[model samples]
Target chain A: MKHLSKVALLVAGVALAACSQPHLDGSGTGTGSGLGEAGSASDPTSVAYFNETIGDRVLFEVDQSTLSEQGRLVVLAQANWLLANSDFTAVIEGHADEQGTREYNLALGARRAAAVQELLVSQGVASNRLKTVSYGKERPLEVCSQEACYAQNRRSVTVLTAGLSS
Target chain B: MKKLAASLLIGLCAFGAMAQLAKAQSGPLRIEITDGVIEPLPYAVPDLVAETPGSNQIAKDMARVIAADLNGTGLFREIPAKAHISTITHFGSPVQFADWKAINAQALITGGVSVSGNELEVKFRVFDVFAGQELGNGLRFKGTTDGWRRMAHKVADAVYSRITGEGGYFDSRVVFVSETGPKNDRKKRLAIMDYDGANLQYLTDSSSIVLAPRFSPTGDRVLYTSYETGFPQVYVLNVGSAQRRVLSNQSGTMSFAPRFSPDGKSVVMSVTEGGNTDLYKMAIGGGKRVRLTSTPSIETAPSFSPDGSQIVFESDRSGSPQLYIMSANGGEAKRISFGQGRYGTPVWSPRGDLIAFTKQNKGRFHIGVMRTDGSDERLLTASFLDEGPTWAPNGRVIMFTRETRGSDGVSALYSVDVSGRNLKRVEVTGGGSDPAWSPLQ
Candidate 1:
């Protein structure tokens, strides 16, 4: 009985170890160890792959689209990945903080996305491969009225879609 | 020097006297006229006249509601019916000017109601309660008993216009999203009502979420957002027929917050495709979408300048959400808002001199006005959350959504003047948001 119990414990340990390993995709940056890096791709159907490169989307100051240095670096890296994965297409969603008029924010969101689109195109990503839209204070990642949440809400998100390569 | 000073003082007094004379002549019904002062006329609404025994209650209620709507704006003050010494129920009846003047009432409103079969006939007259003369001819409105409240509002509008020398907003309506349930699963429906929150009508059932219903300039149609297709999209609804059609169907995308151009021929909205939210302009009839912004930053809330030659919107491209202006054809947008705080919901004033917007600063949201180019930003009201400003027909007042952080946390409707005066709560049966004021009728 003691020998059988020892074997069962060894088998369970191996199973747990295998489950804990972070799976990397073709980009090779997916092994983030669950920190600020890309999360493991366990669910093949999940759209969380877009969140891999940019841990969270780049948030903007109120009524602004100029990417911060960190945001620029993230976009640059995203552009590089898109260039390498030639079959990939992305929709960059521009968002505004919950301030200003709804109509004005829509236009401002478009400007922000256009700014990112221009940058990506300059980096050699095909213009047709990317699309943009603005939510204009409608869809907020955070619901609080505080500035911190508003800051997180003002963002341009790049959603990656599969099946382009196949 | 003495002669010059005397002349100046005399000249000032004469000018003041002339101003008073002009005010008196401006209307036969002069209420709340003060020397050297120009303001919204103060008026008094007496209980309406009832034709039949049963009609009495309805008439009184309708009059009270109308009075409340007018008084809520802080523009008109209703003299308590108790203070009214004499009630002039007929147009031909001689108004007791001395009695009204004694009570310091400026304008007087008296109405009579008669029920003929299924039709209700309302005869109303506005008097210069102080001047002892009728401002205009007695007006008659005939409708069904169900429209008694609307008739009362129509009477109020007539009084408002005759006294203020501006078109009346009382006859108009407001389209808003009514909220219920919890924050995460809040059920929203498209609702419209008379400006006073009467005549409550729900255009869309609470099957899916709706947001930001905007009225067309003519008040015949409405544009709003719906999540019926599992994604937020813009839809146009005919006010009279309750007919609705989708404005955009770019599959697997979200498009919302639609506003009509000045002529009401085109719609400018935010369309989210591929996770990027940008502004796009499309014809009201729905064809040929033109992309307004090609940036990766948020560009939403597109509003046309009064002339439709330019557009103003809020963008976060500059690291924060600020106001920007661009040509109507979409090129070379310039940032106009340089205030210390964040600005959104930039609405161009109908008069073309100012743009009204909601400003968030230091943890408080304020409804404010700025010049067309973003200069002269003035914060009107500050609270936990004051947003979604809709301009009064005259552009003198702004109605907006004010959400006070209650112990349970709820939001309501509130209106304030563009000058930061006369803040009043708009009473609705339920919580309201995204109020769109209609043009003057």
Candidate 2:
């Protein structure tokens, strides 16, 4: 019964997300294939379009917020996507696996978010357009205790917000 | 608090003038409750007598609640009331010590209740069955009928104090974050309730996520982190008014892991800016901020010593999270945790004797404690996920958050005594975490 309810909840959430999902016209195949300057939105891009289509999150290793080469490549693509799409502002939401202390994880999450935000800025994205927040291990992409899920749980997600414009 | 009850008990025994019998204990089976595992002391509690006619049900229920509070401690094993060889009916009747002893009941409790309109009164006494004498003078608590449970707690407190020579936490409360919904997008709010998870009162709505609530010394105010403004910041809540405001809203900064200073005049919290998190102290009434640490590595979770002269916090300057101690005014900090695991959230015990923290090692989390100077380290619990240890106001038990492993993982509050006994899950409404024990009321 518990398993059934959890499955039902997941289906409901996915259906809602698919309903808002737009057509993918860019070179992005929706498969975080690590391609740069991916996912253009209707000859343009919105914040949601950047996140949902181009993949706004990047994963990290255990306790290490320093971006690996692949992580840097993904962020560079993210930076290019943001530079191409000007009206969109991104807030990098940092998170960690559920293996460390709550406070340390909070700081670790902050470090992860900061790493992403700095990469975007160094790539010429305006610093004013980037904000950061750390949910730590309080929020996780996966809930299992194994290493496989832990890898997915440690991530920095660029959550876009509607800026001073409409 | 002890003086208040001591003075009241003295008043109750004045009329009896049975001075020698009052303090007499000739042959009671003494339980010292050492550091090692020991058997629980067996005891029994009979239904309390209803002095007033309409209070029989209330009296009976109060006895059960009192018994549960004591049994929940894991130090006492309650012999079921049904196992009693003798039943208590009269409020002033002498205890049948031989009957209790026959049932292996080392201690016995009897109580009486009187209810009139919205008012209720409870009086109870503990007896050492083996010794055949009342352990202490009877204690009577008077309050509104709505507060009968509190009255019951008072009775349990008196009994616990008389038996253990240590004060009871029955009358205390805990403030924690009540969690619900899915793990990915969980809803959380600040809640206050009795120590046993009774009388739950939500202090904040679920619209914004809240975490790590710490109570002021007076128990009337709470400091917690909220995401109301789209980022985590410390908020001070007036528990009575159910109103709260940002305690720190420094632009472009995220702050969390707040704790009240012993004096309750200031708060010590962690503020993260440009990836660097550090500990800072600010007046509760809103004033100048004092930088307590200047480390480039993560430094947060600052707890003030009971004397308000020093602070215990966690820092990762040594490449892993470790406990550190420094002066309240801020300066060089000496590393304290030399263990193999990483230690964080080092909260100074209210008694000023030890510091409780969450240690992570060998892919397991444990709630552990060490002396203020970092000696006598003992891990009280081990699990897949257990963190955030908050000391009971008496500093005898540590409550923490435990999240089970799996996709359907849930976070719940749990408690264990400092001696590593009485490990029990705290019953709360739905999933709860980050439990902070309130000082005794």
Candidate 3:
């Protein structure tokens, strides 16, 4: 039964992604390969495009969870992308820099993820379509200890998946 | 000096001796541990006499473990066997006091090992060389050959207790999160080992992330946070059986930082709902949930006092993370930390006299301890990142996580004496973090 549902989800994802997926070979054959690929950076609906072009993450200052103006602008764009891609749901993973205690960083990460969730809900995204989890300082995008890396490490990343809200 | 002798007698009695020896001629040889720097007392432990032939390797291995346990404490230094003028050929042989005194050996440990089929038996004694008498009674342990290390630890604990007039922690175990892979995507699983980093066993796989595994008071079970269900939840695992299950399953809420109460009947942890987090206590079997704190700020890392009457935790209600104390039952809490830097992960000492915490100040993280009322706070270590301090079973030492700086930084377990001395890395394969020391087994 579990296997059947997983196959159903993959087939449904290919069908949904095929609508806006750009043809790479221009052969006019919808092979449904775009869903499994790394998702092209030029395709507006691709995961890579959402991550790079539309800005899928927002950073926070050290020891602070309140969103900055620039962070708010980034989240605003993320909200619009989520609103346009109604067939997709997102899981916002919160992270922290290596400057705080493990448990405190987890709570701090939760605050950051919630701040982004609040912004997305206010911008007409369905609240039920979003979930959040905190990784604290365990997962860091940048491993350096300087401010440049720390600023990037303390972030909330919205990861998209092709499925209905749980 | 009279009171010291009495305490030594009591410690020896509590350690379960098989036979009591007469007191030394002058006074009992003891090392009074203090905050001042101490010169490691010299001691010698020759290889245990293998009563049965072909068991020589096991006997030597056990002696090496016991020697390592004593020397690792920094309070005792082992005298090399080559420096010894006399060797212990028999467990029942009378000691040569003049020979040991000539070599400046203050303490002497002698033992014998005998194996019968799968059964192993060990007998040992501690002697004060200059005093010309045995410090305590001789003890014997019987177990399987596979449990020789534990027998060695038991001997080391008894020897340490008799010489230092304090409880021993060598027989304890530590539950920790083992890590591997890169910082961006690390693989973590629950693993446990003897206090000396031997007999390693993995409790869970790296498919799910586990953190801060704490042993129950009896050391039969462990409580930790797991992200297996895509969110943080508390899990109780049976150490012997390796069977585990989620403790709480409240939807729309995330639970983490779980600690067992002194009685092991309940657990206190942080539950996050909406955007804020608060402290909550619930029975281990899942019944009525008691809300411990209701604040707008974050409250986490709650640890019960040894007496189970009070709790010490970290909260950010005062604009920064600091330590707080409150009743075991839900009520108001008094702030206990007023230092310049932020403090978190407050753990009540097993002795109930001190609380260990992780402090971040001036761009450096530290593992520190302070009195229960927040007086005489002392930082024991400073590094790029050092946190999650767990007290030894005797509360005289602390083990914590220390991660180095840079992109290739890895987390490892390090322990320090409570007196701010004897800082050394706990040898474990690969990387480790969030070590929680179990009670003496």
Candidate 4:
């Protein structure tokens, strides 16, 4: 009975997706196979876009807010995306693992968000378009008792909002 | 001569029978010991009676969990089920005194679970096993199936209180931040659960982040930090009604690490204005704010003494975060931590004797306690990172967060006695952090 219900839900989801986008290629055909993508060809300063959106969140190592190279790359991609789309304002939310003190974690979360904000500004994004907040270790996407869950719990996220057009 | 020998043998048999009768007539076992000595009372938890299918498993699990909770405190030693000679099949059955006495059990607990229309009814009785008398009448708790674990905790609380003459913390609740995602981009939400980490209910939907929720003296209100207004600000939440209002609204400034005064009339917290953080106090009813610290250095983690006469806090004015003490009325604060490490989060014991703090040194974190006069420093538990020490009401134990290190680290709640004994991990479904113990209810 459970399997039958799951199959019905899957069919319903596929039908909804098909109904929503009739103009797009339905057979998983590649559109950006040419010499340049649409936006980059129009704008000379536009950088290559990576599909890795930073999940609108950032996480920190236990007791530390220093960003890793992967985290920096995500922030750079976000910065470039924001730079290309000049009307966007973002809020950086910092988070810590469940390991450290609450007050310290809050401070560390702020520091992580601040680090992302600094990097974005350094990458030519406007300072006024950025705000920072720290959630500390209050929210977890995964609820488990072991290390996998804890590792996932420490993060920072970037949220976009409407701002003045460049 | 043969007749004489036979008569002597009969006399020996009669003597043996008399001795047996005398032993049976003696009163139940009782033990008395002075305070300040470490002695554990022996206790037995027999398998609980089940009234329906799967009820037996529920009863057994509940009994075992309760026993573990009690024994983990180091105040009681479980007299293994193998030693429990008599089976407790019902709540009202007369206990077999001889069987319990034979195993040297000082106390015994018997409970039963009944299911009625999706509601669970748990009934429990605590007995002075040695005295062959019931310590208290059987207690019955009725709640939903999800509340069965809490019912078990309530039973443990009753038994613990009856035995120790001190309030049990089992029936309490903890408000902490639940973590997820990666170390770089984690989502946080305000979550609450039973003190044993059961019935985890998320208060906020992670739409905005929250942190460090402390229960009020009455346990009806919670004070915590939230970024809903685009900055870290303290908020008061009425747990029963789920209504929330901002506690501090100082424009453009940051406020965090809030704790309620013992009288519940005011909250003490850390406020950052300009680049300096200091401690401040404000009425819970939203009134005039009073500055508690006037320094250029970081002063955070302010906790009230039991009587609300003094405040213990952590300050980095001395170049490192160390414990400090000041009058509740605000005066020159004196440093109270002289230990060899940086101390933070100094929480005064509810008994008004010592202050529990988190000490970090030599790449390790420790939960430690010290006298009010900067003496008698004792580290209770050492770990990769242990912080946020909150005192149990009796001042006999301290609960803090412990994090283990690896590529993928873990965080969990841990408790330790003041004497540096009986360290145990608190079980929770997901990882837990920033545990603020509530006052004895």
The top-ranked prediction according to lDDT is 3
Which stretches of candidate 2 lie above 4 Å from their native place?
A1-49, A52-55, B1-29
Among all windows of ten consecutive residues in candidate 1 chain B, which has the lowest summed lDDT? B3-12
Please list the residue runs of candidate 3 whose C-alpha ends up more than 4 Å from where it truly belongs after superposition. Answer: A1-48, B1-26
lDDT of each: 0.70, 0.81, 0.84, 0.69
Residues B90-177 of candidate 3 have per-residue lDDT tens digits of: 9888899999988888899999999887778888888888889877678778777877888898899988888777799998899999
- As a TM-score, model 1 comes out at 0.72
Candidate 4 wrong stretches, greater than 4 Å: A1-101, A104-166, B1-40, B48-65, B80-83, B89-93, B111-125, B131-151
Q: Write the per-residue lDDT of candidate 1 for residues B1-441, one digit (tens) a residue.
A: 011000111001222222333333365543332212234445677777776667877788878977876776556677788877877665446677788887877777777777766577777767775556666666677777766666677777766667656556676788898887643235689888777787677888888768899988888899998867645689999887778999998765678878999899999988876546678899999998999888866677778887899888877789777889998888889999998877788888888889888887876678889898777877777776688788888777789997644223356788776666667777788888899998864
Residue-level lDDT of model 2, residues B116-192, one tens digit each, is 88778777778888778777667667777777777787788777777776777898889999999876568998888
lDDT of 1: 0.70
Q: Report the C-alpha displacement of residue B197, candidate 1, in angstroms.
A: 1.1
Q: Name the weakest run of 10 consecutive residues (lDDT summed) in model 4 chain B.
A: B3-12
Question: Which predicted model would earn the best DockQ?
Answer: 2
Q: Residue-wise lDDT of candidate 3 within A1-166, one digit each (tens)?
A: 0011111111110011111221123121111112332479898887778877887778899888899999999999998888888888887877888899889988998988888989999999998998877888877777666676787788888878776777
lDDT of 4 by residue, A94-158 (tens): 66655546675565566677788889899999887876666555444443423455556676667
* Candidate 1 segments whose C-alpha is farther than 4 A from its true place: A1-166, B1-25, B28-43, B51-54, B89-91, B405-407
